[model samples]
Target: MMTDGLDGVVAASTILSDVDGAAGRLVIRGRSLDELAGRTSVEEATALLFDGFFDDRPSGGEWRAHLGQARHAVFAEVAALDERLIRHGPLEAVRALVARLADGEDLATALRLVAAPAVFLPSYLRLRAGHAPVAPDASLGHAADVMRMLRGQPASSVEAAALETYLVTVCDHGLNASTFAARVVASTQAGLTSAVLAGLGALKGPLHGGAPGPVLTMLNDIGEAGDARAWLEAALARGERLMGFGHRIYRVRDPRADALKRALATLGVEAGRLAQAEQVEAAALAVLKDHKPGRRLETNVEFYTAVLLDALGFPADSLTCVFAMGRSVGWLAHAREQATSGRLIRPQSRYVGPAS
Candidate 1:
């Protein structure tokens, strides 16, 4: 039997990460989400994901240096940026720049693909805002440097820690749509850049990485905590799906949502906004329960992702690009794994049309 959208299909085996939807748990390597997220730097998490994937895999410290160097290397491509690319959104602009990288399966190539978003995004954002782009500081950690480049100033300890938590939380989670896309391309022995580009293409879909921005839009529409229930009820009555309340896999609350909420708490978001968000979350949960009593609908990552990234001063439009910065490492790791150990991914499709 053919499964639509390949639901319940086992596409490839991986040692990378697992998403236990029933348990609301995410495990990367051997570590749980809580164990790795706020406790590890982006470099350390990247090292964990990269372990055993490459013959020349760098240690955590070495990965930090290589990631910094990769960022500097990717920064060189910023000179090629122009109004044409910047006219598109940040994700597209970054994807265009990443397309310029030479395709390869080597560790250096993987590192550059991983670093591309962190380098290209701030450059694209700054250029779009009519400011000069900031150069990468190879001495700083990956998450800290990304924040510094985006703001053209150093991020505080709390701000950098928040970003690191966000990055690590999203770094990898089983064979997600984007990770699967990356793996499919890699199974073709397409280089890491091509695999990552495939992942970016998949992630650009609204059903995937694009939901966080709309969550912000929903929050803005609700305006105040007191207004959340009525506005959400009306929207649901009109057949509008709430942006952040449900997940495809997770029957319980998403663990990443809590991870991001904890990260948001550290940023000292304004009292009114946080209170409004908390109230809206409670309201959304209640409304979802009343509207769809049989279905289990709960807060997912996008809800707090919108709140946290907004608190960090990132533009709503660039949130997906920020997501890419973390997930790129996972994509590269998945790509390397597929290229090294897996066969080509060629699935047969049943014909539904009339016979020729």
Candidate 2:
């Protein structure tokens, strides 16, 4: 019964959060993600996360804007390095960029820490495929800068709003796997960037946050609407866990899904793709309802994440890094929270495999 590290010993109540997995609800500081996502900017979410952890949040748009500027400025430092840098994978190039920013201290350091992957990772992906990364203009909003960099073009207000919603929605969660990993690194007093690197590494695992982009691939390969059932059946029959249908923590439909689905709909999702996606959701839900009825294996956040990001033109390969954009805020907030608590997080582990 000891899973992973046997570290799950009923952790004491955390003012941090409460996730009702069976209900698929999350309460961050007593506010629901749905209520928060629609009206919040990524900046606002960051403030809420650090509300208790920090007395001074970069107040208003200042902290968010500052982080945006810092990410742009630091990433630009390496934009010229793209030619040779592209030879390295996006993740590696990203790690190097963080290393370069290791010198800055104050707010600049925190900004660079939060924004490193957001700026560098997308740029790295572009440079690898012979595309140029766009330079960031501080005047632009955070979501706009992200979309502009990812697409190499300016973004409309709708695009910016939708992307910001995503970044905010996923910005923080009660200590999930990746956030906990980040806190573990942060507990050592490692730099914020170091904590994030740990999170990204954990997220890269297929079982964690890596499956959303693939969900789109599954949808595409299913192609015609008629093939969804048979194709999904074959995939399931072969023991493949259908990518977007279930969740490790949520039981009912994921609350994040509704938030994202609402955002995607507001963005007026792309024509046939959205419709196809709707159809796919319908078919998949029908199947899961019949096959795993008691399990509550409904569409999770990843289901809508694929649809939303694809609508925004993110390549599947970039999804993990894209996810990092939103989730990084949560990582930093949690790291700061844990650090402020002064607990070193030394959990006990039971060894089972043959302790030499």
Q: Judged by TM-score, which candidate is best?
A: 1
Residue-by-residue lDDT tens digits, candidate 1, 227-314: 8899999999999999988888899999999999888888765556778889899999999999999999999998999998888888
Q: Each model's C-alpha lDDT? A: 0.90, 0.75
lDDT by residue for model 2 over 193-247, one digit each (tens)?
7777788888777777788878988988888546888887777778788888787
Residue pairs of candidate 2 with colliding backbone atoms: none
lDDT of 1: 0.90
What ranges in model 1 sit over 4 Å off?
224-226
How high a TM-score does candidate 1 get? Answer: 0.98
Each prediction's TM-score versus the true structure: 0.98, 0.90
